[model samples]
Target: MHIGVPRESDPGQRLVAATPQTVEKLVALGYDVVVETGAGADASIPDDGYVAAGATIGDTDAVWGCDVVVKVDAPTVSEVARMHADATIVARMSPDDDPALVEAMRAAGVIALNLNSVPRISRAQALDVLSTMSNVSGYRGIIEAAEAYAGMFGGQVTAAGSTPPARVFVIGAGVAGLAALGAAGSLGATVRAYDVRSDVAEQIESMGATYVRVDAAAQESADGYASELSDEQEAATQRVYAAESAAADVVVTTALIRGKAPITITAEMVAAMRPGSVIVDLAASGGGNCELTVPGEKIVTENGVTIIGYTDLPGRMPKHTSQLYGTNIVNLMKLLTPGKDGQVVLDLDDVVQRGITVTRAGELLWPPPPVQVSVAPPAPASAPAPAEPAPAVEQKARKGTGVLVAGALTALLVVAAVAFSTASFASHLTVFALAVVVGFYVVTGVTHSLHTPLMAQTNAISGIILVGSLLQIGSTDTVVTVLAVVAATFASINIFGGFSVASRMLAMFRKEA
Candidate 1:
């Protein structure tokens, strides 16, 4: 029933596991929360704020000793030693799978829930710390690149000279890569992006960056991740990566698959880059996508190129990142505490819970059964494509249908008019019947795309009907009066509804004041 927030022991880590916002959520879930003093200080959340959210401030041991302890990084050796037997710990556990740490948790009787191991399935996205961290890292990575670059990002047409925009090439069109593309594009940079999954080309272009297409037929991934490429495919993709990175003013590499990161930019590629060009490797924490990237350090190559491999990009913006991470944990907590009784009840059979359970009750339960993220891509088409019908033929068919229907109806009405109407009334009936036929075909023949404008402009006809109905609203015959009133009521809607839609559509073209 007691959940705890522990201060991040890593000096470089500026994020907190639970902010006051998340603490309030925990309290609402029927759990008493204890916050280690100054745990959220790095993220600008004060102890008083935690108290206001129904959490009590306590020492490190007091907080860690609670039934459920939350953290940003994997527990350190000394940190894990302080945990009481059967206590649960949650964090974005490292992928290295260190044996010593595993043994320590097992000996301490700790239940370890690795947030990084949360499945990529749709239901588990809310608790996925990897994506939450990557979302912030992607945006911050661009800012980090701008800081290292020598020139401005956007173009300037000054009286002195016209400066061209900086060119930014992003490798990997994952969450981080797409975010980098958006930030770079917003800064007026000429952005271009590449991804091994050809299906993400539309997503890449939607971020306002050109998607570098490769002459290959790669289907969408089976698990929402980049699958391992064959040797020949890798070589072809690498050629494009090298050429783009070398030519760009700023290159960002965000390729990370499983625990290892492939070398996307090699030494020869780095050497080919122009002087003062900057490269930001977002996958630095997971080894690195760039050969020159030194994890946790920024190094300048001999050719005057800056290679930034900062592993704490998300931590750099502590406030927002902490909130994002805390919300992710709160989502996981909500799932675990479904009864709202302050008790942690995990459904081990569930893919999400089973996947996150690294060590439970002194037993290692990690490397759970693989979860299939998506069904296999459909088999290719066996038949060849046929040419489309000619536009003239298509147009002729549409015109024929409406006219034929209207003419048939008109002929039937003319026969009825002749049989039912007197001599004087027959001529009036024929004229009205002709008008109805012309109106029917005219309205029906318009293209579907023009319906909006047709409705807006057709208000004049509706107004005529409304006026005609109004003339009969005072009819002496009771049945005639009721029918006329109903017709007027329906006609008024067409007139007013048309005006309302037209006004709303016009407003879209006007500038905001």
Candidate 2:
């Protein structure tokens, strides 16, 4: 088996598909590795490194003519033309977003395995190129924002005066959002995050940042991407963004709706933000989260707010990006490698294979056809049989049994109510404790993804509890008054906290400027 590593043809692409370290692994796996000259120069991997790792350094034609070709970007029409019929090509080709790529590969009789299509399941994590790049993008997004903003992220105290910490607002609580949150928090910025998926609130909170809660229902696709919001939801979200952005010194948007343009940050919102603030839109490749963002360009609004919209952030850190991406490719290659023969095998029954294989054996397999199964034919219809009547004695017995059960239940309820009404304070407390325990168990059963929304909803309900606590605060007994005051204080915090979080979450989705 021969595996070729070609230089990325895209002008903006700096990372290569395989590093020398991975090339060595491929060699050890019984494959002859061929790398295009200067293939890894952008990533700092020299041709000598490839040679030392047991790979042949070859020209473009020799490299692309190998049995299997690996690349960073989708193959160009010309590159596809160079591929031998039935030869395999692997890369991060977003086929669904560009069906022409699939068609071109099929026409060229090339097998196309797209790295972006790798599944998000735990078993495929090592092969997840999207996740690997997203982590880099998220971390880089913060660095870019920090560089653009003039103010310091962390608070400082000097003999002259004290500087308050910068406020960072992050939209989206996915991998990128979390990375941004971590980066910002580490720099001493007071970070707040919002996501359409309410379940990520706990994750945000766990990262030492507040999770903004919103009133919107949780929306997530089966693949874990956020679904697009309706017009009404967008409007509500904009209102929240207006409030939060006004107070934010730095805002990073990582929201993405798969296969569609991102929900944009409105021009009005930019105008409302404090001057000198910076906005980093990581979704710039998908047309940006900010209306003012120009993909791959940085622009400053007349009001002094800087909007940085560099689309390929991961590419900026090519060395590490190439290493991570190369590892992912190696993992994927292991899955596709056939036993003994060392040939690339396409197995539709394998989850990883089915996901990444866009074209197999010269056939375009993306948007895979629905599986068809044979069903047995129904038997010919026959006349209905007469229904059997219940015996009078049995019917009477059933009625009697129902009455007896109802009477027993009623008696048990009456006895329990009477005992509770006459119960001592200790007994009442015991019952309350039991109820709390039951509630704890029930709440624990809820999925982690719902924690954010659940927290928001609980905060709303806590308002009613606050009112009850306030009423009790008027009692004459000193101890009772003290307890009531504490309860009321806690309730007030819960109510206000929930609304604050919800408002922040809604702000991320806000469509207005």
Candidate 3:
């Protein structure tokens, strides 16, 4: 089997798909490895390095003509035309946004394995290119924003005066947002983050940044990505952005709705910001989070706000990016490589293969099936039917027993109510505390799998509790009113907190595009 490592032809794509270390591994796996001349030059890996690792340095045609070809970006129409028929190409093919690339690969009869389509399962984490790149992009965005701003990130006290720390506001709490938050906070900037899914508050706070709360329901899809906001929710978010941006020295927007453009930072919000404020839009590649952001250009508004829209932040650190990307490629290759023979095997039955296999065997399988199909075995023979129920007399007897039990319960409740009316406040409080303890235990008994639904249900129950507390707010007793207000406040927290937890868990299931 022949595996080719082609030079990345995309503009500003310095990261290569494989490093010499990865090339050596592939060579040892019984494959003839060939790397294009100067393929890894930008990433600091010379042709001599590839040669040292037992890989032959070849020309563009030689590299693309191999049985397996890998590169950093999607193949261009011209590049696809050079690939051998039925050759498998592994790269970050943005199928959703680049339908033409999918068609091009199909027409060229190449099996395109898109790294971006790798599932978010535990086994696939080592092969997640999107995550590896996003981590770099997130951290780099902070650096870009800080550099573009005229002010300093950390506060300093000099003989002249004290310079205040920069205030950073991050929109979206996904992988990139969290990275930006960590980086900004480490630089001594006062950071705050906002997300449509409220569940990321703890994560945000964990990074030493405050979490901004918005008056909106969580908008997380089942796959764990943030869904499009409703009209009212968008309005609320815009208001929050306007206020936050006005007070922010730097704002990093990483909010991305898969397959759609992200516009979390509007031009109006930018105009509201003070002079010298910086806005870094990490979603610039997919349109951008800021309305005024050009895909690959930086611009300063008349108000003196700088919007940095550089798309390939990961490429800025090509060495590390290529190292991480190379490991991801090697990990994915392990799944496709069946044995020491190094032949590429297409196992559609495997979840990872099914996910990344966009085109297979000259057929365009773009947007692979959501779920794999499985055949169920035939059932065994069934048992005989049971006998019929008892006669009407038995039914009447059962109804009589139920009425007796109900009447007995009603009598007991009446006696208990009379006793409770005369009981002291401490005794009533004891009963309430005991009920809370019982409820806590009941909740703890539920399995982890049901925790999200349980939390949601408890949130609704807490809202009801808030309503009851509200009714008591106008009570004649001062003590009763004060306690009611406290109860209502705590209930409100529980309701919001419950939604936050559920939203966070849902977000975990979102696969990278």
Best by TM-score: 1
Model 3 worst lDDT window (10 residues): 371-380
Best by lDDT: 1
Where is model 3 more than 4 Å wrong at Cα?
96-100, 371-513
Cα RMSD of all models vs. native, in order, equals 9.8, 13.0, 13.3
Whole-model lDDT, candidate 3?
0.84
Candidate 1 residues lying further than 4 Å off, grouped into runs, are 217-221, 377-513
In the range 1-513, model 1's lDDT, one tens digit per residue, is 789898888877889998888889989999999999999888888899999989999998798789999999888878888889988999877635777887788788888888988889888889989888888889999999999999989999998999999999998888899889889988999999988888888788656689898885344566668887888788888889888987899999998888689998999999999999999999998899899899999999999999999999998999989988999989999999989889999789888999888788888886677877875654579866778867998889999998999999999987987998897467545544554555456555643333565683575465555655666667577986897799788877886786687688879969679
- Candidate 1 TM-score, C-alpha based: 0.74
lDDT, model 2, position 313: 94
Using lDDT, rank the candidates from best to worst: 1, 3, 2
As a whole number from 0 to 100, the lDDT of residue 424 in candidate 1 is 47
Please provide, for model 2 over 1-513, each residue's C-alpha lDDT reduced to its tens digit, 9 standing for 90 to 100: 899999888877999988888988887667899999999999888999999999999999998899899888888878888999989999888787777768889988888888877766678889988888889999999999889999999999999999999999998888888999999999999999888888778789878898877787456665656777887777777777888888999999988777445655789889998899999998888889898898999999999999999988999999989988999988877887766345777788987778787887677789643322213333558857659989999999999999999999998976777676754444444544454555455555644443576794575455545654565577677887898799778877876676687688779868667
How high is the CA lDDT of each candidate model?
0.85, 0.82, 0.84
User: What lDDT score is found at residue 423 in candidate 2?
Assistant: 49
